[model samples]
Target: MLKDVPRSTSFGHSSSVGTMELIRPRASKSNAIRIRRSGFQDFRRVGRRENDPRYYRFTLKRSGRIDISVQNREFGGFLGFPTPTLKVRLERSNGKVLNRRTVRGGEFGFISRRLDRNTTYYIRISSSGESVPYRLGLRTRGGAELFR
Candidate 1:
């Protein structure tokens, strides 16, 4: 019975011939860089020029309170030089300012705000003069996810 069974066969040969191009998504036009996680982010140098601000973007994984602290590095303290003041602002994605604080070098400027989950937020840091090194600390409460 097996020998007598009829078998089907294809008369044409198959070939996979085509051009493939991988297209990656373009980066956002805005200069803001995404913050992957919540914690201390140290900026070695910011605001190299006067009035220039560095912007960072982040999305909360859950609804909760966010506490932001910006501390300017005080390298001139021993020399008795005046501490630099850093202006930090928390804003919505659309550029609406939510909170602003001015912090001096060696001290932290803190901003506490309740934010919604899955919403985009921005942090703008500008130095009063020249360039300055700083540390940014992020804390979240009420089970809100920050960073990765």
Candidate 2:
């Protein structure tokens, strides 16, 4: 028999796809989801009211390189609608954008930067037109040592 898990207790719960894990966290004030060190790839819908800009945050355990990618999930368009363009931005905790890219449906946008340890960073995703689903990926390389 399966047991029911309380929604409040579902923090850190994840499902896997290949080497990526899908993280689902409770919505916060900024709706920012925290990305773990192992990294995560999440599927989300954006551009509609209330969810126009999706936010994600992560802090480096140590100095390392971070790579972020975003792509439209509805390839070749869903139903008869054309695929919506996606805008992905990498920003500092203070809201300064480090990089930005506009990616069409079925294409990928990526940004890579060397980040400092214990510093917070944010990824912002939005749609150019109608609301659409998208996949956002975050990966970290190098700097295995954790700060004391």
Candidate 3:
């Protein structure tokens, strides 16, 4: 099953295959080099809008449950900076919530069950009045994986 994640239009294209790197302005210079050396197609800076939380919307191809995972790239790198508390909210397209919790220091996972196949679900990620760079991934029970 192929997962469909709605790409950000902030990159100026509707359909471009690339990885997103949401980093702070101070870290931008080095992060850009790292991202380029890593061979990611492109990198877009999120966490710009102060009040607006970044939303990654994706549709699960099969019915069952999806395992969601989030990682903070800035918190843990060669510098070993302290990790920030990240909040993740999983909700359906209709505003119905599936799960909401705070994660820190470790990988966070949640299983959303009884979802309709091809229906869109949203993963809302934000920090408390701070900009955080993160990577979110999803995997269904049937073995489909979606990463960003």
Worst 10 residues of 1 by lDDT: 1-10
As a whole number from 0 to 100, the lDDT of residue 22 in candidate 3 is: 49
Q: Write the per-residue lDDT of candidate 1 for residues 1-148, one digit (tens) a residue.
A: 0123333347555544454434323223176777877674756556653225777788888988888888888556567768777888999888889999988878878899899888789988887766778888887887888647
TM-score-superior candidate, 1 or 3: 1
Q: List, residue by residue over 1-148, the lDDT tens digit for candidate 2.
A: 2334434225676643333333344343276877875558899888754376778888777887888888787578668777779888888888888999998888888898888887777888888857778888887777632232
Residue ranges of candidate 3 with Cα displaced over 4 Å: 1-51, 74-83, 105-114, 143-148
Query: What does the lDDT read for residue 40 in candidate 1?
Result: 45
As for candidate 2, its clashing pairs are none
Residue pairs in collision within model 1: 36-147, 36-148, 37-147, 37-148
The residue ranges of model 2 lying beyond 4 angstroms of the native Cα positions read 1-29, 77-82, 144-148
Clashes of each: 4, 0, 0
If both were scored by TM-score, which would come out higher, candidate 2 or candidate 3?
2
Tens digits of per-residue lDDT, candidate 3, 1-148, equal: 2344456587687875566544323322112221111112221223444323656666645556566666645445337666556677877778788888776644554544556666766767666545555666655665433332
Computed on alpha carbons, the lDDT of every model, listed in order, comes to 0.75, 0.75, 0.54
The candidate, 2 or 3, that scores higher on lDDT is: 2
